[model samples]
Target: MIESTTVLVVGGGATGTGIARDLSLRGVDVTLVDRDGLSSGTSGRSHGLLHSGARYAESDRVGAEECIEENTVLRSIAGECIRDTGGLFVQLEEDDPEYFEEKRAACEAIGIETALLDADEARERVPDLTPDVERAMWVPDGAIYPSRLGAANAADAEEHGGTIYPHAPLEAVSVVDGRITEATLGGTVERTIEPEHVVNAAGAWAGQVAALAGVEVTMAPSRGVMVSVAYDELDPVLNRCRDPADGDIVVPHADEAVLGTTSVPVSDPDDYEKAAWEVETSIEECAKLLPPVADAPTVREWWGVRPLYAPDEAEGDRRGISRGYFVLDHADDGVENVTSIVGGKLTTYRQMAETTADHVCESLGVDADCETATRKLPGADDADRLDELVDRYDGQGPTDKDVIAQ
Candidate 1:
């Protein structure tokens, strides 16, 4: 059968859902499709760090700036999806004091709030922290729930008249005379979709999706492995005060503390191999930050592939690539009405979507300003609603009935 829409968004990760919500709010007929469910890729596999941009302040100033901006925005609009637990970057006795000073200076230059904490204060905050820690710097980082954030975006999109189809993978792109006309989606339910525009937000698999449309996009898929421990040893996100490297961060997610990760370039997005060394290295390295984690029970482990973008001229390895995203107009490559966005982290998905949506709207002559920044997603006001529920329940714990209303 044949379906039609004003826009077809491939890849139902954070970026794609954000775009669908943005375009739909602007009165566009949008359809989003994904090979798996929302956040089934890198989005769900991440350490869920809602970055304060402090991590990249020195290495990638632009990326750090973007992260800090988006971090504030997400905290405002997506409060329910965030834990708001602050982060700490600790300097061990052997680490570089000069680099620690540089990180603080860079963070201050970018307007990211930084507070230095002495060893006693740092250890008081995180009792499990290694005794050898020299000092610490606090940043406004938080833990984010990927599933909740993506679901909120998807829900808001649907409320605004957008359609989402999970498990529908794009099999082929039907292009004629250098313009995209339709896309073939293959799954249990097959259909050909004729879209006025196609957006590739396929995350790590963006390169493969672009190839289906006969356009070449170079994407370096870097795999990172995360190991989950059974206990939440620290309330704040912990980071090693050094350059970006494997297993430098430990994020507290719900009751578990997630220790991660290793960045190794890979050829396939689906090649999520959990090497024994990677897991061992993560525990050993993260143990330097929190000693309890070394002996904690490892409950689970998984791997995520980052959609690193390095054009031919761009230098350095995957770690050196900027976390900033790219919105490629295939028209520049001789394919019309198709745009592919890649290379951003979850913290800046909304901004990435806004940028891509702006380009798409301009190309189609749609005159609508982006309202996603200020608009609240579905259930975003649930905290207020929960307060009302509390009053209705006379300050007692909410019963199943009251919870259902929310």
Candidate 2:
């Protein structure tokens, strides 16, 4: 038997679930499917540091502004899914002082709250901080539990009458005459789906999904490693106040600290070289900021692929690619009813979904304003309930494996 929905959303990560919740709240019928489970892709494999916009303040002004705005909104609505641990961009003795000043000035210019802390003052906040830290700038950065966040969004969408299918992979898509007529989903929910609109939020695999519909989405995915070590003393997310490089950030958790990451682009997101150097280098660099993590006893390590969109020709260092999200209307490429949302950070998933939902709603002529920003997700305030939803949706991932029991 064939099924149908007003909207078919691919991928069950934060962004896909966010879109489902947004559209469902607006009286839209939505069906979301994931090849694996919620957050099983890039969303679930992150170091899970909630950005405070300070990291990108110097480089991308507009991206930083969007991050700060969404960071504030998530703190309000995400509840237990987020931790208000604050963030510190430390300038070590070996680091550039001018770069530190530049970031501080950029944050101030963009209205991102920040405070300059001397080495003595910074050590007072986090005693485990390296004494090599010459100074530090404090921002509103925090920690995020992606499993809980993804589950809450999925639960909210389900409450609003949206259908969610975990372990349901989109096997094929039928695009006829500039429109997507049908989509064939495999795995547990093997069936044919007729949809009025299709959203490809498949993260790193977005290019593959788009090709199923005969659309081209240039994705420049890079691999990064997150090493979680057994450390309980760190109180805030630590960012190296210099150029964006491997092991620049450390995200603290209940009994662990996640060290991340190295950027090396790959031709295929699914299959890439998992070099030992990536993991070794991340731990070595992160240990500079928090020296104790060097011997903290590694708990577990996982690699996450960044779902970066490169519409233009390939260039040097994939790190130069923008982390900003883009909502692509495939109609420009000949498919009218298919859209792809690509290249965004986990911190801005809600905004990414809001933008994609708005475009899809407009294309479908559904006159409805977005309510996701204001409406708190289901299970937002309850950790147990959120974990239960995570299990229900099979949303557990290595990013928060320690936080949420499988």
Candidate 3:
């Protein structure tokens, strides 16, 4: 037997759920499916930093501006899913002072809001900070709990008459005359779905998913390791005030700090080398910023794959790739009814969804405005309720497993 829906969204990460919720709120019938569960992909495996735009202020002006705009929006609507712990870009004595100055100036130019702090002030704020901390710049960065965020979006989507199926993976797709007519899914949803429109929000696996429809969407995935260590006193997110490098970010949790990560290109997101050096290097580098983390016992470790889009299979370091997102209207690739959204950070997921939903609306000629920016996610103000939503949707991820209810 075959089921039908107005839209079938592939991938149940933050972007997928956000898109479903946005469209459903706009009165569109939607069905969302994931291979495992909500946020079981990159969304659930990130360092969980709510970007303040300061990280990219020095290099990508447009991306940084988008981040700050969305950052403020999420803080307003996400509620308990975010920790308003603020953030600091710490510069060590051995680090380049000119780079730190450039970042600070860039933040000011981009209106991200910043405050320069001396070594004494920095130490006072985070006493565990290394003695080499020459100075620091405080930004509005915070920690985000992706499990709650994804589950909340899914719950909101379902409430608006959308269907969500976890543990349902898209196994086959049939295209007829430049349109995806039906999709055969495996796992719990062992049947075929006839969707008027299909959205591939598969993140790192976007390229592979697009191929199923005879369309090409290039992806350059990279693996990074995040090691959560036992610690309790850190109050703010710590960032290395240098260029974007491995172990440059440390996100605080309830009783641990997630030290991360190293970027190494991989041909396939699912198959990659999980090297011990990456873990060792992350700890060694992050320990420079917070001395106590050097000896802190390791609680857990996991790896996440970045969904980096490569048009020409770009060369050089993978970190040079932009963190911005792309909403591909696959009509250009001869698949009119299918669209793929890829290559974005978790911080800007809602905006990514809004944009994709706008594109989908245009294709379907549905006149609806996106309200996700203003509509607070279901259970946004209650942590326990959010965790229940997570449990209901199986949206728990390693990044927030410690913070959320056990």
Candidate 4:
């Protein structure tokens, strides 16, 4: 038997779930499918930093602007999935001062609020910070629970009458007359879906999905590794003030701190290998920020492949590629009724979804303004109300972490 829906969304990460929720909220019949569980790919493995746009402020102005805008929106509507720990960009004695000035200028240009902190003030907030740190800049960065965020979007999508299918990998995409008519499911469960529209939100694997439809989409799949230390010394996110590079970010989570990541191009997203040297390098580099990290026990280590996209002729290292995303309408490539959204960071997932959904709605002649930007997600209501609840309970009630985890 074959099931039918108005839209079939492939991929179950944050972007995919965000798209599902947005479309369903607009009264569209949507079905979201994933090869594994929700957030089983890059979304689940991210370091979960809610970027304040400082990291890319100097290197990529557009990315920085998008991040800051999305950061404000997410914090307002997805408070339940984020911990407002703030963030700091520390510059050590050996780091370049001129670049720090440039970063500050860029932040200012992009409307990201930043406060310069002298070494003493920075150390006072994070005593574990290396004494060699010359100064720091404070931003509104925070830690997020990507899995919970994705789950919340999925829950809201389901509540709005959308169907979600996990562990359902696409086997074959049947296109007739330059349009997608049906898609077959493979793996443990077998089924078929026919939809008027198809959206590929497969993240790093989006290129592969487009190929299944007999079209080509070039994507640079870059792998990054992150290590989790058993100690939690910093309350705010720590970043080295400089251009984008590996081992420059450290995030404090529930009870531990996570140090990461290295960007290197890879051919196969699922076949890349994680080296021990990468793990050692991340620890050694992060230790420069927090001295205690040099000897801290590493409890876990993992890696995620970024679905980085560039034009076919674009050339450079993976890090040089823009963090911005693209929404491809296959009609331009002579194929109709299908679109693919790729690239961008977890911090801007909602905006990416809204943009893609707007295109989808336009194609289907459905007129609906996006409500996700203002609508409260499943567990996220009013930020002030949540804080009041926390204050009323204090040490006498379940912590915010416990509530979010549930």
On lDDT, the candidate that comes out on top is 3
* Higher-lDDT candidate of 1 and 2: 2
lDDT of 2 by residue, 91-168 (tens): 999999999999999999999999999999999999988989999999999999999999999888898899999899
lDDT of each: 0.84, 0.93, 0.94, 0.85
Inter-residue clash pairs, candidate 3: none
Tell me the spans in candidate 2 whose CA falls farther than 4 Å from its real position.
none
Worst 10 residues of 3 by lDDT: 308-317
Q: Give the lDDT of residue 363 in candidate 4.
A: 95
- Clash count for candidate 1 is 0
Tens-digit per-residue lDDT, 1-406, candidate 1: 9988999999877899899999999999999988766667788778788999999999999999999999999988986667789999999999999999999999999999999999999999998899999999999999876666776787778888998886688999889999889899887448999999999999989989999989988988788888888785579999999988889999886668889889887888886566799999999999988989999998778788888888762334678777889999999899989999999999999999999999999988999999999987777767554334223212221111122233
Q: Write model 4 residue lDDT over 1-406, tens digit each, in one string.
A: 6999999999988899899999999999999888877777888777888999999998889999999999999988897678899999999999999999999999998899999999999999899999998999999999877766777788788889998876789889888899989999875458899999999999989989999999888898888888888786679999998777878899988767888889878888889888888898889998888878878887778888888888663345778888899999999886799999999999999999999999999999999889999998876654444433323212111112323333
Model 1 ranges off by over 4 Å: 313-316, 381-406
Name the lDDT of candidate 3: 0.94
Q: Which pairs of residues collide in candidate 2?
A: none
Candidate 3: tens digits of C-alpha lDDT, residues 1-406: 7999999999999999999999999999999999989999999999999999999998999899989999999999999999999999999988999999999999999999999999999999999899999999999999999999999999999999999998999999999988999999999979999999999999999988999999999898888999999999999999999988989899999999999999998888888889999999999999999989989999999999999998876555799999999999999989899999999899999999999999999989999999999989999999889999999999989989899954
TM-scores of the models, in the given order?
0.93, 0.99, 0.99, 0.93
Q: What are the RMSD figures for all models against the true structure?
A: 5.7, 0.9, 0.8, 5.0
